[model samples]
Target chain A: MKIAILGTGAVGTTIATKLIELGHQVMIGSRSNTNEKAIEFVNKFEKNASNGTFEEAATFGEIIFNCVKGEFAMTALKSAGKGLENKIIIDISIPTDTSKGAPLSLIPELCNTNSLGEEIQKAFPNTKVVKTLNTMWSTLMVVPTMLKEGDHTNFICGNDEEAKNTVKKLLHEIGWKEGSILDLGDITASRGTESLVLLWLRIWGTTIGTFSFKVVN
Target chain B: MKIAILGTGAVGTTIATKLIELGHQVMIGSRSNTNEKAIEFVNKFEKNASNGTFEEAATFGEIIFNCVKGEFAMTALKSAGKGLENKIIIDISIPTDTSKGAPLSLIPELCNTNSLGEEIQKAFPNTKVVKTLNTMWSTLMVVPTMLKEGDHTNFICGNDEEAKNTVKKLLHEIGWKEGSILDLGDITASRGTESLVLLWLRIWGTTIGTFSFKVVN
Candidate 1:
């Protein structure tokens, strides 16, 4: 599978590396094709890895992972242009407002009533936007088995059923068990997952190591 | 110990019953001293249970549980009057906006930057407010062992350390293991727990039975 990852940050680089290891072609996109970090990422993997501008990467892949920071996700996707049409976008961004400093706060406009996932879905109606992998640490996103032997839960939500199923398959390839994946239904559910970042940060503050939520019956 | 539970809803009655069974004198408060549900709740456990007006209950107990609906919590507390002074309030309410109908939505003003727990704390500056048990179904609050052998988690947050300790002791009496209870810092952390209701409701929409979150490493 050809995968496009938008951003050259920790999350984007981490996911791109894992996808390449799983034998998928991964294109790490950035503001410019010449971005040093994207170039460095491509250099780390000789084959099945490349660097390109956002638009080129989006056009090159069947599935796109919006790993851009939540605050800049919309702008980055807009730059990806019409290439996103009909493609499945696995949105893993949280609209965090860094301006507040310490104790992390989300962007007010996107907090409760609306979310980045819904916004992207609304802006690019032709695209299939599935929101997942935004609730935990970037390292946990690609390797669920690293903690609790992959017993924790992962949530996904989107309007398109087929897109969610495809994303679920990709998640399985990345090491998540089928039982660990929870489909939260429709894009609106992103509000719940995104809001979870608030609790996640607090838990991180108190705990000694990385953790994830397990839904126990 | 004497415990007061404000409101005659499922949560109030449930917690009231548990307190009585645990050998604590329990008072179920309501808008009127003659509320049918409160009266019935008191009658269920004649020795340790009683019913009264909000102010009467508040004055009768050393600790109070604000089990009223989130939208009306502050109003109910205010009606409880000066009797709340210096008392510890175990607040377990979510400010759900039912006006929109179907698919739960929180009151916009309290959804992100603020929460009902903080509001109750602010309204009664002299009282100690500890927020917990608002994230799960009412039955799970007093009998956590009913599911997953009580392995799931419960969260509490408050500005007062002593008050939090008292709440923790009470939680132990209600069947929650000390390891299962997580202290999420000051009252502001209530935002995280309260926001969890969005995800909780969505999960409930999909699952067949009651469930709770267990933070796993």
Candidate 2:
């Protein structure tokens, strides 16, 4: 599969390298054509990896992974242009307000009313946006089953059935089990997954460790 | 231990029964002294159970459990009056906005800035407030190990270390394993646990089953 990973941050680079290992063609996108991390990533994962501007990468791949920080998400997607239209976008950005004094916090936009995923979908009317991988650390996003006792769950939500299934298949390729993949119906469900970051961060702070959430029956 | 559960809803009643089984003296509190559910709960668990007005129950116990709905939480606690002062109050209420139009939603009062636990603590300054058990169903709260594969995590947070330790002890008395109890810092951390209800409700809606969240390392 041809994949575009927007935002050359930690999450984008990490997943791009993993996807390349899984035999998927990956393009690392950045605001600048000469992004140092993007260039370094392409050099490290030489064979099937490339670097480009956000718009160029968006045009280059069949699927787009929105891994940019939530604050910059709209600007980045808008830069991706019409190429984002009619594509499967797996959004994993958290709308964090870096400006908030001390410990940092999420913006929450209009509070509990709408989610970043819903906003992205509203912005790009033709894009099929699926929200996933925002609930855990980037390391766990691609290899959830890697933890010693990891039978944890990962969630996905999207308006389009086919798009959701496509994203689910990609998640499976990356090692998430089918049973652990919870489809939380429609894009509005993203509100729940995205909001989970508040809990995840608190858990991280006190434990001083990284972890993922598993739903126990 | 003498425990007062304010609110004769399923959560209040269920935990009251479990406390009785655990050999704790349990009082079921309600707005009205003759709430039918509270009367039946005392009849069912006749050995160590009783029913009373919120104030009577609050004064009757060493520890208080706040199990009322978020909307009614303040009123219930205020009704409990100065009796709740200096007592360990285990708050399990999610600050959910039951009045939301559709799909149900949380009222991010002060918008991610505060939580119901914080609000309650602020309301009753003399109370030693500890937040726990808001993340799962009432059935799972008392008998978490009853589920076929039940080795999930439960979180507790409060400013008073001794208060939190007391709540942890109560949790252990109800079958929660020591390793599964996560202490997530001070009372402000309640924001994270309360916010988690959004995801819990979403998971419940799609899965049509009761489950609790466990943090997988």
Candidate 3:
């Protein structure tokens, strides 16, 4: 499978490397095809890895992972241009505002009533937007078994059922248990998962190690 | 220990009943001393149980539990008046807006940056306000052992260390394991726990059974 990862940051590179290792053609996208970090990332992998502009990368893959920062998600997608049309976008972004000091808070306009996922879905009605893997650290996103043998929970929400199923298969391939992936209804449900980031930040402060949430009954 | 529960709602009654069973003098408060629910509640218990107006209840107990709806928490506290001075308020309320329909959303003004817990703390600067148990179902709040042998997690946050310690002791009496109670710093952290309600409501829609979150590493 061909995958497009939009961003040159830790999240984007980490996921791109993992996908490439799984034999998927992965492209790390940035504002420019000449981005040094994106170039460096591609250099780390021998084959099935490449660096390109957001538009070039989005145009290259069937599935696109919005690994950019939450605040920049829309802008990055827009830069990806017409390639996003009718494609499945796995949105793994949180609108975190670091200006609020330690233990970050979400962007006010996109915090509760509105969310980046809903916003992207509304903006790109032709695209299938599935929100997942935004609740934990980048390292845990690809390797769930690192903590509790992957028994912890992960949530995915979007308007398109097929898109969610595809994302679920991708998650399973990344080592997440079938039962661990929770499908949380529609795109609007992103508000809930996105809000969890605030709690996640606070919990991170206490234990500066890798951790995730498990739903217990 | 004398505990005041300022509301006749399910959460208030549930916690009050448990405290009374643990041999603590419990008072259930409502808008009026003649509230039918409050009277009926007191009738069910022979001793260590009483009902009164918000003011009477707050004055009767050394610690007060703000179990009232989040929208009216400040108003209820104001009605309780000077009795709240220097007392600890265990706020177990979420500013939920059910009008938005199923899987309730938080009130716009109180969702992200601000919270009812912080508002109550700000309103009564002299009082100690600790926010906890607002993230799960009412029954699970007191009897955590009902799920997974109480191995799940609960969070408490407040500006006062002594107040938090006092509340921690109370949580232990309620069957929460000492390690299960996570202290998440100041009362502002309530925004995180309170924001969790949005996610909790969605999760509830899926299982329709009793469940809670356990932070796993």
**Cα RMSDs of all predictions?**
1.0, 1.7, 1.1
Docking class of 2: medium
State how far residue A72 of model 2 sits from its true place (Å). Answer: 0.7
Candidate 3 residue lDDT tens string, B50-163:
999999999998999999998888889999998898999999989987678655788888868888899889889999999999888899998898988899999989999999
Candidate 2 stretches greater than 4 Å from native:
none
- What lDDT tens digits, residue by residue, belong to model 1 across residues A1-217? 9999999999999999899999999998899999998998798777999989999999999999999999899999999998798999999999999888766878988977788999999999999999999999999999899998899999999999999999998899899999999988999999899999989988887864788998888
Error of 2 at B54 (Å): 1.5
Per-residue lDDT tens digits for candidate 2, residues A93-189, read 9887778864456785724678889999999989999999888889888777677534788899999999999999899899988888898899888
DockQ of each: 0.77, 0.69, 0.78
Q: What TM-score would candidate 3 get against the native?
A: 0.98
Candidate 3 Cα outliers beyond 4 Å, as residue runs: none
Number of the candidate with higher DockQ, 1 or 3: 3
Q: Weakest 10 consecutive residues, lDDT, candidate 2 chain A?
A: A102-111
Give the deviation of candidate 1 from the true structure as CA RMSD. 1.0
| CAPRI quality of model 1 | medium
